[model samples]
Target: MPLMHQLWLLVPWAVFALAAGVKFWRLTRPFRRQLAEPSTEQVRASLERRWRADQRELTE
Candidate 1:
């Protein structure tokens, strides 16, 4: 096959890859935001409460 034909074959694959990448980024956007943002004070307090409860259980 000619080089031009080979290059043409790659076009669809490239488009599909770009589309899939965009879809994946959109789907994971919320998770990415959570990772990027700092934990809020309320979340920190809730985690501390849970840790204290677990510690009490461990001591008993």
Candidate 2:
């Protein structure tokens, strides 16, 4: 009922909102980048390069 109690209750919701926003941004980033690119071939090449870089990083 007090202002402090109300603010305390909102802490969890605020944390959840921030986490969800970050997750949504990360999930959409690849699709958004692909859409902005001019050609499918370019997109494919870029994704392949990224995959290779990930593989190399893992091997190291």
Could you tell me the lDDT of residue 17 within candidate 1? 100
Q: Which candidate leads the pack in TM-score? A: 1
Local error of candidate 2 at 1, Å?
2.7
Q: Which ranges of candidate 1 are over 4 A from the true structure? A: 39-44, 47-60
Clashing pairs for model 1 are none
By summed lDDT, the worst window of 10 consecutive residues in model 1 runs over 34-43
Off by over 4 Å in 2: 37-60
Predicted candidate 2 versus true structure: per-residue lDDT over 1-60, tens digit per residue: 999999999999999999999999999999998778478798799899999999999999
Model 1, 7-59: lDDT tens per residue? 99999999999999999999999999878857688689989999999999999
What C-alpha lDDT values do all the predictions have? 0.93, 0.94
